[model samples]
Target: MGVAGSGKTTVAALLAGRLGAEFAEGDEFHPPENVAKMSDGMPLEDSDRWPWLGHIRDWLAEQAAAGRSAVVPCSALKRSYRDLLREAGPVRFAHLTGSRELLTERIQGRAGHFMKPAMLDSQLATLEPLGDDEDGFTVDVFPRPPEIVDEIIAHLDR
Candidate 1:
């Protein structure tokens, strides 16, 4: 859970595979309108995001009901959004953090993605880092994805 270019999806996918947990790309949960909005370089407002967040939460609930562990990577930029996700069940966030320059470079390097590098500032501005009370830990994005996953797994084991 971090900004647009924080490697959330890549790391979460690898983490899910490592844990043998169900995997969902949170971006896939966004409605077409949301996609269109982002594609048009507009940052989504809270109202536009609530339903999308609900869908992700509901999917997690379904996985839990089926007795499966799941990993989903979401921007979840605000504490309120994370709180809402927790309503689904016990959720631990692995925040992929890095310097602004690194994040911008990563986003700029990407292609065919709805999220534009130009929008990274909006996401960064919106991001609320995990509080001490939150059930989560931060992992720097400087390490490779496998190393990031290892750190997360170790943190969970502890």
Candidate 2:
């Protein structure tokens, strides 16, 4: 989990492949209205996100019950959201963090995604960095993607 443009999707995909786990892109589960709102440069309200979050939680629960490993890329920016996922199952998060400037540049360069760089501010504003009590590892997004994947796997292996 991380802010927009922090490479959560990229890292998650690589990690999933390495772990032989299913990759679930949370954005693909967004409701059309939510997609439309985001495409219009609007941030999603808590009310708009609750149902979507519930869906993700359910999916995680299902995967966990099936003894299936999975990598999910989601912007669980709030503690409450993280708590919801935690209640759903046992999971570890690998947070990709980077400076605003770097993230802005990355977001701008990204194409074919409904989320726009203009929405980055809203995402950053809402993001609450992972706390000490959270079950996860935090990695800065300066290194290459393979390095990031290696770091995450190493951390998890520990």
Candidate 3:
């Protein structure tokens, strides 16, 4: 998980397809109010995110209970947020990271998305890189989506 322009959705979807796991877009779990706030160029407070994170966590738990592996793309920016999601089960994160300029360019390139380039700074400021204790690997976003997915899968294999 990373910021908005980190290619989480694209890579996660491809990863899910390759693994034959259930896939969910994390943004869909956000309440309308959260979406509205982001759309209006306002960064969401932690209070606004708890419920949304809970919904995503619940969905992950549901998938695990059903005996299915699931892939979800989320901007899990904080260690606390990642900790909350870990309660769902054995969650492994793949943090897609890149330079600020690259992230801004990617965000600007998107269209019809609620997240805008102007909001990237807020997200970057909020992001906490995966800690050594975390069950995850960080991948550079410079690679193609397939390459990124391949790297993540390779790490999982290790």
Candidate 4:
């Protein structure tokens, strides 16, 4: 996971296809009100996120219980959020990172997404890069989606 417009959804979707895993979008876990707020270009408070994060975690737990692998795209911007998700199951995050200019360009070019371009800065501010102890690695967003997925697979195999 990374900031807005970091290609998390694109990468996660392609990765899931390659890995033959179920795919979920973290944005879909957000409550309607949260989506409305974001649609209005407002950043959500922490109180608004806990439930959404919980939903994502629950999905992960369900997938594990079914003995299936899944890929989820989420802006797990904080270490605490990552920790919360890990409690549901064994999860390895693939953080998609990019330059601010590139990220903004991506957001600007997008359409029909609830998250507004204005929220990018707040996301960036809240973002905490993967830590040394976290079970994941960061990937630069410069490469094409397939290339990014290839890198993730390569790293996972290592």
Tens digits of lDDT, candidate 4, 1-158: 98899999999999999999999988999999999999999998889989999999999999999999999999999999999999888999989999999999999999898888889989988888899999999899998989999999998898
Worst 10 residues of 4 by lDDT: 109-118
Which pairs clash (backbone N, Cα, C closer than 3 Å) in model 2?
A: none
- Once fitted onto the true fold, the runs of candidate 2 whose alpha carbons sit more than 4 angstroms away are none
**What TM-score does each of the candidates earn?**
0.98, 0.96, 0.98, 0.98
Residue 106 error, candidate 4, Å: 0.4
Measured on C-alpha atoms, candidate 2 has an lDDT of 0.89
TM-score of 1: 0.98
lDDT score at residue 9, model 4, on the 0-100 scale: 91
Give the clashing residue pairs of candidate 4, or none: none
The clash count for each model shown is 0, 0, 0, 0
Better of 3 and 4 by lDDT: 3
Better of 1 and 2 by lDDT: 1
Q: Write the per-residue lDDT of candidate 2 for residues 47-139, one digit (tens) a residue.
A: 988888888888898888899988899999988889888877887888899999999899898887888888888888988878898899899
Minimal lDDT window, size 10, model 1: 117-126
- Residue 60's lDDT within candidate 4 is 95
> lDDT tens string, model 1, 36-58?
99999999999999999999999
As for lDDT, the candidate ahead, 1 or 4, is: 1
Estimate the Cα RMSD of every predicted model relative to the unseen true structure. 0.6, 1.0, 0.6, 0.7
